[model samples]
Target: MWRLKTHMLVHTNEFNYSCGYCPYRSRSRSSLQIHERTHTGDRPYQCVQCHATFSSASNLASHRRSHLPPVFSCDVCQRGFKFKQSLL
Candidate 1:
């Protein structure tokens, strides 16, 4: 039973297959199938704020930060950032 459970967990965690031309990882077979679009340069998500497109949701989230005001500013140069931790 322990061996069977371990094997199942291994299968569940595996995302060993990857696209040869791009960096993308998917644990599920379906997700891997979807991720193959990157190699083809297919971006399905488009930003409503600026019409920018991204290959993945995480990239879209990061891109959205560009539309917002900086949360932190440089004390000496007056440079700003959307993230407070960027100050450090």
Candidate 2:
């Protein structure tokens, strides 16, 4: 219903949300806000365990993984890896 209508905007090239700082346009308001951060240099999402900050929550989440224990370990070098693909 409502969700499908929003998704269909991509096919129609109807990016109504325009950035005030740049020529970038987004289908959603949240996406536009994230893009605006590039112009403002606003890094509000801070890591609790570190001084690292990011403009977006997703970036902060990925950074948070550094504080976690590695899930996989290399058999040859005995080195640790957070992602299984990294081990291979």
All candidates' TM-scores? 0.57, 0.79
lDDT of 1 by residue, 1-88 (tens): 9668545756576776676566776555546655786568788888999899888887899889889998789999999989877888
Candidate No. with top TM-score: 2
Runs in model 1 with CA error above 4 Å? 1-13, 16-26, 30-34, 75-78, 84-88
On the 0 to 100 scale, the lDDT of residue 34 in model 1 is 58
How high is the CA lDDT of each candidate model?
0.77, 0.91
Expressed as tens digits, the lDDT of each residue in 16-81 for candidate 2 is: 899997789999998999999999999999998888899999999988988999979999999999
User: In candidate 1, which residue pairs clash?
Assistant: none
- How many angstroms is residue 14 displaced in model 1 relative to the true structure, after the best TM-score fit? 3.9
